[model samples]
Target: MPAQPDYTRRYTVEEYFALEEASDIRHEYYHGEIFPLDGPDGPEAKAGGTKRHNRLVQNCVVALRLALRGKGCDIFSENVRLAINEADHYNYPDVVVTCSPADRQDPRIVRYPSVIVEVLSASTEAHDRGWKFQQYQALPSLQHYVLVSQRRRLIEWYSRSDSGTWILASVRELDEAVTLSALDISLPVADLYENVETGPEEGPVLLRLPD
Candidate 1:
């Protein structure tokens, strides 16, 4: 891994919050640095999402919406920001599910999300599976962290176990379903890829551990 820029000009959390409110584009704040989230720049811009990625997000939203109806959980997309902790880490997940009544108090940010989803692209996959995943684990309320691949028909489910360890499960079969134990709902893999072109499973399967 290469070294990241120092970002000499760091901003305070309050300053970053103000910048986020005034900017037209979205930005993610971590520690003391603010990074843009959109345009042909920034981390997510490296391997910009394809048409399939967008469709998958929509499918997930629809599936999760119907399944979670009247369950006292509100679903949000990338439009909403997630605050992982007090000092650092604020992100915009592709899909967010919050059930805590406390989260309703803040409209600008979600403090506690039961489930957070990220649609992976070639550029963002590494950060999603590595750094971002590590940081997201800090949230006590996050029971499920889902990663959907746009390159292939793959879904990586990270569920928090009773012992507080994150267990990884890979779902690849198109006919199979992804069970979100935290939400008590299952989403069919086929439905998520509806009308989307997911090429052959070329690369190694995600989180393929020994049986």
Candidate 2:
């Protein structure tokens, strides 16, 4: 979903909660600022994606949920808020998986997440790969972060190592799959784009951990 800065007054955590309670739209809160995720204030409503976008997201969520069923890990997609106190933020990830007992008890905010998947669009690409991913790294329980592309059948998989470093890898070919060692499962690049339509593919992406 597209996150646009709300130029209004800064809000406390309490006030932000109140705003969310009274409003039907979903907004992300960060450091007393509210970023509306939907509505006219937001040029393209991200909380709700295009039909093509929705299909991609559903494919990811359904696959993860089916794989983790009865294993105690819960899979959630869209609208579920993840609270990052380390960053003073509350934002909704497109897909979130958690096995934390503490998260199981909480209904509103997820403080711990094992895996996070985001289907990227032009507007959200930079933010998702930059600030949002940085904030997510603050969650100690997070082991894998996946970025699904709408322009092509690709997934960028970032996994944390035992030595506490993150390694960046990706699968963009149809027959390729990325293994999530922490989850003990492999997701095919083709599987994620199943039944989904996309625009023209972007130029090839070459990524490595920044120095």
Highest-scoring model, lDDT: 1
Poorly placed runs, candidate 2 (over 4 Å): 1-7, 46-49, 201-211
User: What would the per-residue lDDT of candidate 2 be over residues 84-169, giving only the tens digit for each residue?
Assistant: 77355788888899988889787877888999998887657777788778988988999999999887667898999999899999
Q: For every model in order, what is the number of clashing pairs?
A: 0, 1
Per-residue CA lDDT of model 1 for 165-190, tens digit only, reads 99999899988988999889998998
What lDDT does candidate 2 reach at residue 210?
Answer: 18
- Candidate no. 2 TM-score: 0.87
Model 1 ranges off by over 4 Å = 1-8, 200-211
User: lDDT scores for all predictions?
Assistant: 0.80, 0.78
TM-score of 1: 0.87
Candidate 2 C-alpha RMSD relative to the actual structure: 5.3
Candidate 1 differs from the real structure by a C-alpha RMSD in angstroms, to one decimal, of 6.2
